[model samples]
Target: MTKPESAEQDHGYDVVISGASLAGSAAAILLARRGVRVALLERRSDPDAYKVLCTHSITANAYPVLDELGLIPAVEKTGAPHNDARWHTRWGWIEPKAAPRGPELPHAYNIRRSTLDPMIRSLAARTPGVDLLLGHQVTGLVREAGRTVGVRASAPQGEREIRAGLVVGADGKDSAVAKYAGVPTQRHENTRFGYLAHFRNLPLDGGIGQTWFLEPDMAYAFPNDDGVTVLAVLPDKKHLPAFREDLEGSFLSFIRALPEAPPIDGAERISKIIGTVDYPLISREPTAPGVALIGDAALTSDPLWGVGCGWALQSAQWLAEAVAPAATGRGDLDRSLALYARTHRRRLRGHQFLAVDYAKARPFNPGERLMFSAAARDASMARHMHLFASRLIGPMRFLSPVALAKATAVNIRHRGTAASARPRTHSEP
Candidate 1:
């Protein structure tokens, strides 16, 4: 990548991005590739700084974007597990026995955040026109006429003001940039606490992602890189004591209690049991004036689905594609922001709605039970369920009128079979 000449301290670049996570870095690379000078800021000074010990699964739905970014080869080169998913539904394990139908049915990547974050950040830094500003912490928004115009950041050498046509909050759920800009957001409480640790050598679940939807308690085993698997258990608030009293014991017991528990009973632990209890479901307006938000800064619901990584990259792609013309001075910035927001809502709202509803720790509703059971019993139904989980389709589309009709028929047939299977009872006189 060629070195970029520094622009004036005032209005320095085409875009000023707040965080250097997936969304931020992705936006930087995409924009800079189109001759948009970008200032990508990271609070941590180290170029290798990565999101630690958190979710790092990116579904196959985002593979096209990854390929577009020229990241697929590098990511594959890392030897990250190419994992298939199996969902434990009420009826049974809903596993797709058929091979992937096409190139679209790609295997998802399960790499550690420690590796992924740095890799992506490095990719952005190496882009031609991106000024990767490490250790720059955004202190306040620079607003003009009630519109975000720039950001005031604090760095090792004191403070500096950088301006741009757009400022993006790619920061995490508790977004400092969004907060400083006073972006209005709808917040939902998470009724469950999550705990996890990395284990090595679980032969039964080798290179396969297994998620159990046990109502009120959920478990995930993500086969990750370097022969490691990250095991997570999310339990309702009422079940917090089991984790508090004995972390390992409770985690193991919960896994053992799972109907389709893997032979991870004696897997070797490779990391400490870390957890998060106060993770919230947040949804904010995606744009504010000259500022736009992406990834968790815009929306973060239940982590149980592992959609965060995909959304981060996806929303960045949406924003960059929508705003590229604006960055190049060909389109209206506000209109572009509006388009991005509309696209974001249209693409994500259905999934967010269902995720928020499930985050409340409630039992599965009739529709959910119907879908899960049908998906378990029928291969055709399982394919749709698999697609939905892979982020290839949204909830509303997955549960169409035809789907409901099929689910009803499946349930009726199962009921009939059960009734027939019941033995005849003879009453003695």
Candidate 2:
């Protein structure tokens, strides 16, 4: 794809992207690759803006997108390879090895947000036909005849108006673009709070990320490129106060209490503890006439699975592909935005629905119990669980009758064997 020629004047661009984070920058790169001019706006002046409160684990499914954008080599230089997943549950530790997939579909990558975000933003700036605007915060959307045409932004230079045929909202969970564009959003009340920090000297199994399902409360530790590791805890709302009082101490204690805890006991803290309270996972329709939303701005899934970064990049790619022809004047902008909206909803709604349902803090449903129990007992079941976790299969596949029946049979047989091995109880005289 050839790069588009830049507009001679500075008042407008082919597309105006609000928020220069992962999603926005990725969209800019994709648009530029397809010969579409883009103006990427970010509130922060620094090019190296970082999202401090993220786990930054990109699943294997996202690797193809990164490779297609020519970013895998650059990202791999700063990120650690993540290939295996170790689940610590009441039953036992279930380790799922990476499937023997080709290099195109390798395992996961664990890169700190501090490093990953900046790298992608820099690439966006360097891409031809992309105008990277920093330190500019958008305050309002410009509408022409009831359709979005541009944005009203405020920067140190003063207020300015930049017009574009298409406007994309990549601002984030508390997105101003969605609000100004009048896209209705429904929020699920997630009472879970998360606390995370980086540490050194933590003993982690090489190349594997570990998650402890401490029923009700969950903890995860992922090793990154540098000697640093990210440890996060998702605690019930009631226990939030203790975490707030002593952030570092409480975070360590929570992880240590897990059944097969990560070796944080001898670890030295490398960063200040960060906490998000009552962070509900939210989902919203991502488009309107001449406007669209991507990433967290579109749908906020539960962070428990570490899917935010991957989903953000993936959605950005989807939006860029869907809107390219319209931005180039070959197709209608409204139709393009509508198609992008439908595609986003179709790809994400089912996944988000199931995630939000499980976020309700209820005990595992029968299907979940059966699947996990089977994974604990058999390697093949573990591989199936991995495929589901990595999102290679849809929810329907995971919940299919055949899969459920196999899991149920495994669970029942195991229970029967345990029951037969137990000594019989006798009545006392």
Candidate 3:
């Protein structure tokens, strides 16, 4: 860990990043690769600080960035590869007919944050020109003439101000950097909470993730390494009292009540049930003059899709690529930051919109019903749906008029055939 030098000391750096988690650490590594000096500040004293209330599932889309950062092997050691998904609804189990066999760009990884955060932190500390500062709590942003210049932080040694060319907010959803930078955020209350825990000795099939859609309530289980399974239940707000009374019992009951969910009744618990009442929040803008926001600090999506970690890593990579040249004095900083803002919106707006709408607890819209039903009936449709869900394909590909029409036709034909196959009753006696 980097020690906090006195304010008078010459500790010049090109960038100062707050919140030394996934986004912050990734940004530091990327910038350092470009030969830019970076100061990475973390509030937690423990260098191994990980987000306890996270799903910690990295999607297929995030693998390229991890590979680029040379973290694939490290993460693979701690994670299990996840590909297939099983959705249990009133209609029955909608599992992929076969494993998605194709040119695997990067499948998802089921990892626990406890193992991931420390690994990335160590990597950042070893990267040249990167200063990893643990146990430093940022008090506020330093602005000069309306431009973010650096950050004011309090460490065990004492209070200090660190100046830099640019400031990056990689903090989580409730980011102090965003607040002090005066960036406004838009939050939608879904009136739901999530209870999550890990279990051992569970008979969970590897290579697949499971999601039980119990209409207003939902439960999902992901098989992780070391014969552990991560299970979560998203319940409506009306059931808060039951959960508040006995967290473990209520969570277990919720999972057991789900139709076709694996029998977790006999499974041994590996961790205590933890609950997060506020799980959904979306920010309006991710960047400003001289400062940029990454990860949950910029925008938050519902955990139902398990894209938080992927988005965090992706956002960090995007910001680093956008700002590296400028930080190294090869381009205009304002132009670089502006381009980053636009690119961020272009990449995430559609997905975030869909996630926010779904977080409302509304039933699948006509388009969604068509797609899901088609995927349920046709293996080809399932592959396409899987690609889209994994973020390999853009949303436009799934929402195209041709794709929607085909899905609608398939769903209608399936229902029609089922109706025709039913037995008829006699009219006369």
Candidate 4:
């Protein structure tokens, strides 16, 4: 911890946020809307830039936040559409037939980060109190009296300091602010690597997102903007050798092998195949002194779950709500930061645990099989499962004792029915 006292403390903004992408921009928008000063720093120079290596499936849980930001209509205007999600389990596809979640709950958004990022940055940069400092790379934390006051950033002009009451790290998984703040993180080993490619003219349900959990291998297909469908696969490392041999060939082969494979025959690859193998599940305590972390900076889970974009927006909302009064000078800022930290942990701990558990790339256990089977049999179970996956409901609600018992009984009944149908040999008698 490098705590140094500065001779001339420069308090420029209420909050200096690193990374002007999803989380940082969203936080800036929130605070700026409330007339709190914000400095949004981004390393990228391009105003239209987006995160290229992402599947970009925004979960339903972030819909409310989008609405609050007044950006949902903008996203829709950009051809990004609402999505209905279905999960493929061992028994069958756990497809919920319910209408899309209301404004109070999370809902799905199928938009590329290319469109989403610029839209988000535009909103933040245009906010009255936000200063969008593009092409700025955060180098170190500005410390005063043993608390992080802001950041030392290098921009196109030169290196300079930006001071604030609080500094936020929304800088993705390998967060420089988190590193500078000496924030503690727990890394979990991930057994699977992810690959995603966009295809044009793919024949599929227009606004439906589908995921197949074939044990150690999982694949998802979502129809996104501009008549393109994104197909992604998470295969265990054991299968990487074959994929490395032929990137495009192997990706197509793997997806084609799924039980009810996507109808992508004769589809054109619109983008280069994007992939990542080093995505370890990362969970960090989201605050340090005067600094707070949001998005992947705070907690990065399995990519197979497609929760990053949603979590980024949702966490930003949580932080903004938690610290608004303090940042506006109505309450103690440190106590407000602590409040944000506690709220972040409470909201994400259970989700992170389950995501990390699945990141091990292991096949479903008996309990999981029971739940999946029950979800396949019961619409209510399927709806609950979908709500949990979308992050509209927490783990405690999704994994209650009643749900577990129902799943167990459903599985037992399925077993009994199968056993009754089996032919018996007289030799045993």
Candidate 5:
């Protein structure tokens, strides 16, 4: 470990966060708001730089965090629509109708990362007590007596040592801080690969999102800001050879072949189709002495569910909430770190487990088949599924005895009339 005093300049703060992306920026902003000085570091030179290969769906479970950060209005100003998703299942469509009156139902948001990332980064930069260090790439960590003391960042001018009471690794799944700190990570293989591209003039109803659960394969159409629709396909590895032979042709054919497929032929392609064959599920123990990890740095779930963005924001909030009092000189930092770790696991571990299992691209289990088929036949069943898929409820509650019993009864009731009750194909009105 390098001595902190050897650097040309040593900056001190309550927290030094690596990577000024969603997790880093949100952590910095929330920590700074609680009277903690923060140094937000980003390797990217451009302030407007955004992640390109992302579905960019923020789940409804994180709306409270966005509201607390005073970002909802700004988010709306970007023309991001509240996304209500409809799923295509083997039984038929599970499209729940919205309640006509009373309190509004929860919904997720669909905004391209190109518009969302810069907006949040700028917000954090403008926040008081947050020193946004652009182009400062974290290269090493400063440790003393087995505790991470700070980070060594390489900047345009020279190497600078930043000392802080707590070091945060909000960088990404491939986190330098986690790597340098020797955090243990568990990797799970994803049997399905993904490909996506943006299009214009897509006539999906009310810009709502659509997902097709084709057993081992999946596809999605997310209508986003500025009249853009992102069409994506996640196919099992068995199709890899065909996709590798002709990327665009394979992607287009896959989407066009979906039951009640979207109007791909009618829409104009706006961006190059991006494909990624490998993105293993990653889960890391999120805390060490004087250190805490957030966002993809801590856990990278299957992209098939589009949980990364919301989890990034939610994890940042959890960390800041856990450590803010300690950083403000009012509590024990170690205890706070422990609390954050516990809370993180309690909230996300089950979800991550399910996501990793499904990432293998296996056929749905018996429970899934029962629940999905029942959902297609019953409105209440569909609503329950909507809540679960929107992430408003956890797997525990979603798979509870009550829900399963309800689903079983629904299936029994529809046994004879199920075919007649099935939703019309997407080609219908």
Candidate 6:
């Protein structure tokens, strides 16, 4: 690792990034690779600290970035499962089967945050030109002439002021940098509360991930590293009291009641049930002049889709790609910032819209019902659903005119068959 240049003495770094977790660290590494200096600040003193309340699923769409970062081999070595998902709907199971000679299906990874966070952080620390400053918490932003220029942080040594060409807030949803920068944000209510726990020896066929869309409620069993399975439930607020009364019991009951449920009862429970009763969906302006936000700081959509970790990686990549030329003194930083913001919004807006709408815990609308049922009955429809649900494609493509037509035709064909198969009661005696 290169010695971290004194940020204050070096006329400031190219970028000062808050939060040395997934987004922050990855941004630092990517920027440094593009010949820019970065100061990656993390509040936690412990290098091994990890986020406990995360789904920890990295969607397949993010694999390209991971491969570029030289992390896929390391991630696979951690025993994380390359997971394909199957959804249980009222109509039936919407599982996309691979064609015999077709290209390999896309798959995500299920790894615990405990292992992933520190791994990425360590990689960032070793990368040249990245100052992974642990135990440094951003207290405020440094603004000059109404533009954010850097950050004010409290370091283990003492209060430190780090100036930079750009400041990035990679901190979580409650981003102090965003707050201090006065970044415009939107918040939406999530009517569903969540609970999850880890278990050992859970019998899931082929270790494939399973999800149940029980109308207003949802449940999942995701096989993770080290032979552990994560069982999670997201129930509407109407069921909060029961969950609050018997958190473990209610969680288990809700999961066990699902069709083709995992053998949780027979499995050995490894972690206590963790519950999050209220989590607001948040979206912030991705960039402001010299300041940029990534990961949860930029957008905290519903976790039901398990897009957080993947988005964190991809957004960091996008920010680094957008600003690297500017940071390296080849372009205008403001234009770069605008590019980053535009790219971020373009890639995530549709996904966020759909996620926020469903976060209300509303029952399936006609469109949702039509699509989900069609997905269960038709392989091509199921493949499209799988791609969208995996965050591999945008909503526009998933709900394209062609997709809608195919779904309508499949449903109508099924409807006709059902009517023809119906038995008639004796009439006109």
Candidate number with greatest lDDT: 6
- Tens digit of per-residue lDDT, candidate 3, span 246-295: 88788888887777666798888889888788776677588877799999
> Which pairs in model 3 have colliding backbones?
none
lDDT, model 1, position 263: 74
Backbone collisions counted per model:
0, 0, 0, 5, 0, 0
CA RMSD, predictions in order: 3.6, 4.0, 3.4, 4.8, 4.3, 3.1
What lDDT does each candidate get?
Answer: 0.84, 0.81, 0.81, 0.83, 0.87, 0.88
lDDT of 1 by residue, 66-89 (tens): 877898888888889765888886
| Candidate 1 local Cα displacement, residue 211, angstroms | 0.9
How much lDDT does candidate 3 score?
Answer: 0.81
By lDDT, the better pick of 4 and 6 is 6
Query: With candidate 1 superimposed using the best TM-score fit, by how many Å does residue 424's alpha carbon deviate from the native?
Result: 10
How good is model 6 by TM-score?
0.96
The digit string of per-residue lDDT tens for model 6 on 1-429 reads 323223344345899999988899899999999999898888887889899999878888788888889998999999999868899988989988776788778886899998999999999999988888888899988888989878888865677788899999999999999999889889999999999999998989666899989989999889898888998999999999988898888988998898988887899999989969999899999998889999999999888889999899999999999999998789999999999999999999999999999998988888898899999998888888978877888989888999999999998888777668885443210
Per-residue lDDT of 195-292 in model 5, one digit per residue for the tens?
Answer: 99999988785558999999899999998988898899999999999999999899999988999888889889999999799999999998999899
Q: What is the lDDT of residue 286 in candidate 2?
A: 87
Q: What TM-score, over all chains together, does every model reach?
A: 0.94, 0.93, 0.94, 0.93, 0.94, 0.96
Worst 10 residues of 5 by lDDT: 1-10
Q: TM-score of the candidate numbered 4?
A: 0.93
Whole-structure CA lDDT of model 6: 0.88
* Per-residue C-alpha lDDT of model 4 across residues 69-100, encoded as one tens digit per residue: 99877888877766677788767888877645
Q: Residue 300 lDDT in model 4? A: 92
For candidate 4, give the lDDT of residue 178: 92
